[model samples]
Target: MNATDPLLTVEDLNVRFPTRQGVIEAVRGTSFSVGRERVGIVGESGSGKSMTGRAILRLVRPPGEVSARRIDFMGEDLLSLSEREMRRIRGHRISMVMQDPKFSLNPVIRVGEQISEAYRLHTRASRRAARQKTLEMLEAVQIRDPERVYQTFPHEVSGGMGQRIMIAMMLIPDPDLLIADEPTSALDVTVQMRVLAILDKLVQERGMGLIFISHDLNLVSSFCDRVIIMYGGRIVETCRAAELDKAEHPYTRGLLAALPRLDQPQARLDVLERDPAWLKEQSVVAHV
Candidate 1:
């Protein structure tokens, strides 16, 4: 693939779940592309932000349907790949950092061992080499005293440390694209900044594409190069992060208005007024 070409291209992606009430669409006709840049997908809870990420990885489980016109990654059509073929792509070529390390981490395993296992799985490296690589990765994420942290179990580490460990584990194989779903949401402000800095540094150094999914509009606008605003399972607006304030869609405007600005303090933040028409409106396709 050309350097100018996108790392991943998703078109007409849809995720649905059948329930007793009806077939609920979690993601509807969402289309976008990611180059070697950070792209943020922002919206309220249940707006399909996480589902979109999962859909790209084909992680939506049975009973939940995922269909797309095309999901091209690195000049290969992901939708056409077999289950075994996709497994090779998942962690070795693409990695996903889930929201909570508490649920994602192995409770019974040592942190360092788990990270080493990830590296060995894809590269078939020797145990000694994998351990050395894991230690280096932990340090890369700004974890002090990697040796001590390596011996500790998941439950023994602090939330911030656990998050850093998760990032280290996912990045060990050096994936070309990373889909981070609210990776820093559970941490404090200081820790959140630290994690974001680590992610930003890695992306720049590796020249990899990133899809950052979050609900914090201000954070996304500041950290990402481009922003895709979603509402009711569809993209309502797409623009440069610096141009988020000038978004024309009613849903995007309402979301921005609801944020509490330090400079412009108000008696009460505005409530987001939803419109039924937004669900039926055509999704705004993101070019980058």
Candidate 2:
């Protein structure tokens, strides 16, 4: 792909769910473009970050609705594709690593077999070739004993190991874009660093676009090339990662203030005061 070409372009995206209480707008008119670079979506719970990722894959189930003026991927309209076509693209071209590995992985299958299945489904590889590829993927994710981990079941492995296996499975097909929804949130700090390093290496080496959805402000600022701050089902602010500390929007500022700082230690961090008007305000996109 050309450097100027966008890998994915989402415009006027909206997600809604009907409930007896009321209709909940999970995401509202969100627009963004991602090239072969890391884009971070940061926000608290119920900010619709995860929903946006799922919508790209058309994963939102019934009772939930996803509408977009255009959800284009590599010049093709994703919203227009049939379910079968979308499935062909989902893992082979665009993959997602969900937050919890326990729920994502198949417990009945062996780790290596599951990974090999993903490869076989996307390619014309034989079972032997797929198994070999799966082993390589396990090593790529820094799995110490790929041979041993290959035979182990999901429940038999540690949380960190299971998470790594999930990543290896997602990347086995060498997707063009990877939407990682809080992939590191469940791991300890040390394991989180390891997982991030593996993701960073793969993204850089393969030149793949990444949508990293997370609530960790500091992690996003340091790890992503650009950041999108979501609030009340909309994007409130967007800026270069380096300039995150200098964010201007009140919601972004409030989020930054809430982060505990070692340099400016506080007995208690200030709670974010939500403004109803923010939901109506347009997204402020600041150039670094």
Candidate 3:
């Protein structure tokens, strides 16, 4: 890769959870990156897409251990950073939009306060300055009434606004990278599109890198610049967004086949054909 190729890079990233039963590897030897590009990681429920995001941030807990030979971000070694140093880099330099806005946002605190707090943590800004920046961030996400919405608690706002508020809080710090893990999955279809648009716009305006993690292959195909199709805790294929139609992997093709369409009323959609070959390949890699 070129020196300017990637803002975030991972090589041989492995995450494991040691249970009484055995070691459950969530992400096994996964390698990928994001430059000024919007890279999407797509897979089924247990494919480790979210785990990969957490690994990048070093958010994996005690039982869930993250180890990598090279997990470099902005040319710095992420795996070698201390807890205190990682804290400084986590939200201040790189932010995350978690799966559910309700869970991510504080229930009791005013939304504005939470976003302002993030800004204050990153910069030596007074509460007033942070509040100003927070409101502006909210407005940028297309919130109609920034003042009223600022005062509203997380429960008081609708799902769409809550997710938007989450976006505001994450972007308030103007981070170099943003890991949005199923950020808009809880919202309605219309709202989901809007939220994605907001993210796309903000990323473009800031020239920041984004890692959008999700299970929605179709959504990733259209929205992201590049797609990383992962299965069984490893990347199965990587392709450009426009070239998704010609993806060769059995898993990728299976995902595309499973999507519902409105144009044609097919009596029975051809569910994907699973091949034993892909599983065999995984086994070989695992044993290596």
Best-fitting candidate, scored by TM-score: 2
Backbone clashes in each candidate structure, one number apiece?
0, 0, 0
lDDT of 2: 0.90
TM-scores of all models?
A: 0.95, 0.96, 0.92
lDDT of 1 by residue, 165-199 (tens): 99999899999999999998878999999999999
Q: What would the per-residue lDDT of candidate 3 be over residues 139-227, giving only the tens digit for each residue?
A: 99999989998898888888888888888998899998999999878778899899999999999999889999998888888899898
How far residue 85's Cα lies from its native spot in candidate 1, in Å, is 0.6
RMSD of candidate 2 to the true fold?
Answer: 1.6
Question: What TM-score would candidate 1 get against the native?
Answer: 0.95
Candidate models: Cα lDDT each: 0.88, 0.90, 0.84
Best-to-worst TM-score order: 2, 1, 3
**lDDT (tens digit, per residue) of candidate 2 on 32-107:** 9999999999999999999999999999999899999999999899999999999999988999999896578888
Question: Which one is best on lDDT?
Answer: 2
**True lDDT of residue 174, candidate 2:** 96
Q: Which ten residues in a row are the worst by lDDT in model 2?
A: 267-276
What value does the lDDT take at residue 165 in candidate 2?
93
- Candidate 1 at 9: error in angstroms? 0.4
Backbone clash total for model 3 is 0
